[model samples]
Target chain A: MNQQETGAGEIKISARDVQVHYGDNHALVDVSVDISDKMVTAFIGPSGCGKSTFLRCLNRMNDTIDGCRVEGDIRLDGEDIYAPEVDPVHLRARVGMVFQKPNPFPKSIYDNVAYGPRIHGLAKNRSELDEIVEKSLRRGAIWDEVKDRLDAPGTSLSGGQQQRLCIARAIATSPEVLLMDEPCSALDPIATAQIEELIDELRRQFCVIMVTHSMQQAARVSQRTAFFHLGQLVEYGETGQIFTNPSDPRTESYITGRIG
Target chain B: MLWLTFLIIVAAAALAYVLNLRAARRLWAEGARLHSITTFHALYALFLAALPAFVFVVLWLALSGPVIGALVLSGLPDEVRAGATAAQENLLLSEIRSLARGQAFGEPEPWKAAAAARLTALEATEGWARLALVSLIAAAGLIYARTRVSASFRARQRVERIINGLMVFCSLVAIFTTIGIVASLFVESMRFFARVPFFEFLFGTNWEPQIPIREDQVAGAGAFGWLPVLLGTMVITVVALVVALPIGLFSAIYLNEFASPRLRAVAKPVLEILAGVPTVVYGFFAVLVVAPALRQAGQALGVDVSPNTALAAGGTMGIMLIPFISSFTDDALSAVPRSLRDGSLALGATRGETVAKVLFPAAIPGIVGGVLLAVSRAIGETMIVVMAAGLIARMTINPLDSVTTVTVQIVTLLIGDTAFDNPKTLAAFALGMMLFLVTLGVNIVALRVVRKYRELYD
Candidate 1:
C-alpha cells in the first residue's frame, strides 16, 4: 500500500503550520497534514514526541489544559476549529475523543453511553435515546457483555469493557471525527485486537485519527501513518510503505524498533 | 518516695539497654549469628526492666489509698465508728487523712489524732514495702531479659509484640474514656429522672430549671420541660444550614472547578480563618454587631425584631461554620477523579454542567456528609447562642423571635456552685445525654454516607 492507492477519500481535517507549547516547553513544532474522511490515520512516535499533543489539537482537547497554547490553523470540514467565534463545547460535540486510559464517567453503563447524546440533545424521546445507546454500544463492540447490566456503574466493568463504553459514549453524539489518544495502550493484547477490529469497522462512517506508541498497531489498524520525532513530523505516508519502504531514516529506525 | 522509685526504674532501664546491647554485640563478635539485631535486644531489655516496675508502682499507688483507709478505719475509736452513717464515716476518714498530713482543719478529736498517727506508720511501712517489691521485680525482669538475649533469642518479635500490645492499650483507653463519659451522663440523668418524670422533660413545652436551694425560699420550684430548648436548637440549626449549605457548596465548586491555583491558595485559607476564630469571639461579634444590625434593619423595614433573636445567633454560627463545610466539600469535590471531569468535558459538557451533573453526583455522598457534620456542630454550639440568642425558652419558629438552645440551658444550669443532688444541675446531664445522642446519630450517618461514596471512585 502507498499514498496514491489510499488517496481516494476526501480530505476531512486539514492542519497547516500547527505548533503547540506548554508554558516554557515548545512541545509540537510546525506540522502540516491532511486527514481524509472514512480513513484511519495513525500518529506513531516515541514518548513525549508530540504525537498525543497533535491528536489533542484535532478536537481542541488541549483547550482544557492550563498553560497549553496552540498556534496556526486546524480546520474540520473546511471550518476553522480554533476560530475565536467557535465555541469549544459545540466543536467537541462534533469531534469526539477517547483517552489513553479508559475513562468512563462514574455513572451507570446506560448513562455513560447516553451522556454525550443527552448533553448534545440528539434524541427526541426516551426510546430514541435507548436506540442510540444500544446502537452505539453495539458499534463499540461490547454491547453483549454489558447488555444485561446496563444499570451497573460504568467503572464496575472490566478495563476493556470500560474502554469500549467510553468509545460508545463518544460516538453516541454522532460525531463527524473520532480522535483516539493511545486508545489501546492500557489494554491487553486480546482487548487491543478487539479495539483494532472495531476501529476498522468504524472507519466506514467517521474519520478516525489515532495516536499510538505501537508501530505494529499502526501497521495493523491505520491506513495512513505519520511519524513524529523531536516534536516534528519526520514522515507522512501509508502504513505499509512506512513499514516496508524507507522514506526517512528516522521513520525507518522507529519502525524497525532501533531508535524509538 | 514514688517519684524516687520512678526515677530509679528509668535509670535501671537505661543501664539494662546498654548492658544488653554490649552482650548482643559480644555474641555477634564471637562468630555466633544473632537472630535479632543488637538494637532490638537493647529495646526489649529496656522494656522488660521498665514495664514490670511501672506496673508494680501503679498497683501499689492504687491499692495503698483504700488499704490505708481500711487500716485507719480499724484503728479509730469504736465510739467514732459506732452509729455513724457511711457518709459520716467517710468524713471521719478524710479528717484522719488530713490530720495525718498535719493539715488539720479544726480542733482534732483525740481518736482522730491517734488514728492519724497509726495511718502515718502504716503508710510508711507500705511505702517501704512497695519500694522493695518494685526493685525486686525490676531486678527479676532484667535478669530474665538478659538470659533471653542469647544467639537464638527472637528479640525483634518479642519487642514487636510488646509494642503492638501498647498500641492496643492506648486505643482501649480512648474507647473506655468515651464509654465512661456516656456512663456518667446516664447515671446522672437517671438521678434527674427520679425527681422529675422523663416524659415531662421530653414532651413538656415549658422549660424553667429553677430549684430552691433553701427550704425558706418562696419561688424556686422550676419546670424542667425540654421541648422549648430542643425546638430552639432545631430552629437555629435549620437557619445555619440554610445560610451555610449554598454558600459553602458554591464556594467549594468554585474552588475546585473555576478558581486558578493562585486564587485558590489565597482564598481557601482566608475562608478557613473563619473557622479559626474562637466561638467566644464569634459570640461577641454576634451580640455586638450582627444583633444590633439586624435589629436596626428590622426597625427600618417596620418588622418587630427582638434584641436577641435566633436569626442573629444562627447567622453568625453559619458564618463560623462556612469554612468547615467549604473545606470538607472542597476535599470531596477535589477527590472526584480528574478523569470523570475530563470524560464529561470531552462529551461537550460545559464546566458548570460538568460540575452539576458529573462531579456533584459523584461527590454527593461526601457533600451530604459534610453538611451533616456542620449541622451537628451548629446544634452543639454554645457561646454564640448564649451571647446572641435569648435565654427565655420559647417554642417559636420565627427567626426574628428570641430563642434559647439546649446548650445554653445546660450552661446556665451548671453555672456556679449548685448542689448536684438537686434537679436543676442534674437536668443539665439529661440535656447533655440528649445532645450526645443526637450528634452521635448524625456523625454515624455522615460516616456511613462518606464510606459509601468513597468506594465509587476506587
Candidate 2:
C-alpha cells in the first residue's frame, strides 16, 4: 500500500503562520500544517520541541493556561476556530483530547466513558447513553476487559487500562477530530502496542492527531509525520519519506540521533 | 546573683567549644581523618560540658531557697514552732528572709533576728558550694570530651542521636499536656457524677444551676438536666452552619474555580483576614450591630425579635467562620489534580459542569471533613454567645429567640464565688466533659474521612 494514500480523507484542519507565546517566551514559531480527516498524523520531536504546544493549539486548549498567547489562522473545515464568536467549550466537543497521564474522573468506569456524552447531551435517553458508553469502550478496545465491571471505579484500573478509559471518555463525545498528547508514553510496551493498533484502526473514522516522543512509534502508527525542533516545524511529509529522505540537515541529524 | 551564675556557665561552654574546635583542627592537620567533621566534635564537646553543669545549676537554684528556709525554720524557738499552722510557718520564714535582706520594718523579734542570721550564713555557704560544684563538673565534662575526640569517635552520629531524642521529648510534651488536660477533666467529671446521678444529668430536660452559697439563703434543688443546654448548642450550631456553610463553600468554589488570578490573589487574603479578626471582636459586632439591626428588621416585618437573640450571635459567628470554611474548601478543591480538570475541559464540559460533576466528587471527602471540623468549632464557640445570647437556658430552636449554649452556661455556672465541690461548680466540669467528648468525636470522624477518601483521589 502507498502509505501517503492510505485512508487519507478531506482536510479537516488547516493552520498557517501559527505562533504561540508563553509570557515573554516565543514557544511555537510559525507552525503551519494541514490535518486530514481520516488519517493518523503524528508530531515527533525532542522534549520542549513545541510539538505538544502546537497540538494544544488545535482546540484552543492553550486558552486555559495563563500567559499563553496564540496568533495565527487556525481553522476547522475552513472555519476560523480562533474567531471571537467561537466558544472554546463548544470547539472542544468537536476536537477532543487525551492527555499523557490517565486522568479519569474519580467515578465508575461506566460514568467515565459516559462523561463526555452526558455533558454534551449527545444521548437523549438512558439506553442511548448506555449505547454510547458501550460503543466508546469498544472503540477504545478495552470493552471485553471492562464490560463485566463497568461499575468499578475508573482509578482502580491499571495505568494502561486507565489511559484506554481516558481515550474512551474523549471519544464518547463523538468528536470529528481527536488530539492525543503522548497518550502511551506512560504505558508498558505491550500496552503501547495495543494503543498503537487502536490508533491505526481509529484513523478510518476521524482525524487522529498525536504528539509522540518515540520516533519508532511514529514510524509504526502514523501515515504522515511532522518533525519539530526548537519551536519550528523542520520537515513534514509522508512518514516513510521523512524517515528515509528528510530534506533538511537538522531533520536528518535529529533522525540520525546526532542532535535533538 | 542567679543571672551572674548563668552567665558564667554560658561563658564556660563557649570557651569549651572554642578549645575543642582548635584542638580538632590541630588533630586534622596532624593527618587524622576524623570520623566526623570538626564542627560536630566542637558542638559535641560544648553540649556535653555545658548541659550537665547548666542542669546542676538550675536544680541547685530551685532547691537552695527551700533547703535554707527549712534549716532556719527548724532552728526556730520552740514557742514559735508549737501550735503554728503551715501558713504561720510560711509567715515566719518570710519575715526572716525580709530581715536578712534588710527590707523588714521596725525591730525584729529576737527569734526572727536569730533566724535571719542563720539564713544568711546558710545562703552564703550554699552559693559558694553551687559555684564550686558547677565549675568542677563543667571542667570534668570538658576534659572527658577532649580525651574522647579521636579518629574513631562518631561525633556527628552522637550529636544527631541527641538531637533526635530532644525532638521526641518536645513532641511528647504536647502529647503529655493533652493527656493531662483530659485526665483532669475526667477526674473532675467523675467527682460530679458521684454527687449527681449520671442518667439524670444525661437525660434531664431542665438546666437551672443556681445553688445559693450562703446557708441561710433559699434556692431550688438545682435542676442539672443538661438537655436544654445541649439543645441550645445545637440550635446555635445549626444557625451558624446554615449561615456559614453555603456562603463559605460557594465563595471557595468561586475563588478556586472561577475567579481570575489577579482577583483571587487580592480577594483570598482579604477573606482570610476575616478569620484573623478576634472572636471577641465578632462578639462585639453581634452585641452592638447585628442585634439592633435584627430587631429593626423584625419590627419592619411585623415579627417579634429579642434584644439578645441567637440569630445575632450565630450569624456573627458565621461571618467569623466564613474564611475558615472557605480556606479549607479552597485547599481541598485545589488539591484535585490539574490533569483531571484539563481532561474534563477537553471533553467539552463547561467549567461549571466540570466542577459540578468531576471536581466536586473528587473534593467531596475534603469538603465534608472541613465542614464537620467547622461544625465542631461552632458547637464550642463561646464569646459570641456570651456577649449576645441570653443567660437563661431556653430550649427553643428559633434563631430569633433568646437562648444560652453549653459554653455560656458553663461560663455562668463557674463565675464568681462558688465552691468546687458544690453541684453548681461541679456541673461546669461535667458540661465541659461533654463538650470535649463531642468535639473530639467530630474531629476524629473528620480526620478519618479525609484520610480514607484521599487515597482514592490522590
Q: Choose the strongest candidate by TM-score.
A: 2
Worst 10-residue lDDT window for candidate 1 chain B reads B212-221
- Model 1 stretches astray by more than 4 angstroms: A1-8, B96-128, B453-458
Instruction: Report the lDDT tens digits of candidate 1 across residue range B223-258.
Output: 988999999999999988888988999998998899
Real contacts retained, model 2: 0.81
The fnat scores of all predictions, in order, read 0.62, 0.81
Stretch of 10 with least lDDT, candidate 2 chain B: B1-10
User: How do the residues B1-458 of candidate 2 rate in per-residue lDDT, one tens digit apiece?
Assistant: 56766776788788888888888898899999989989998988888888899889978888888888888988988888999998999988888888999997988888888888899899889878888888888888888888888877899998898688779989999999999999999999999999899999999988888977679869877888999889888888888988999999999999999999999999999999998898889999999999999999999999999999889988988898798899889998999899999999998888999899999989988898889989999999898898988988877888899989999999988888789888889999999999999999999999899888877765
The parts of candidate 2 lying over 4 Å away from their true place are: A1-7, B58-66, B83-109, B116-124
Task: For candidate 1, write residues A94-190 as lDDT tens digits.
Answer: 9999998998877889999999888888899999999999999999999999899999988999888889899999999999899999999899998
lDDT of 1: 0.90
lDDT of 2 by residue, A210-231 (tens): 9999999999999899999999
lDDT of each: 0.90, 0.90
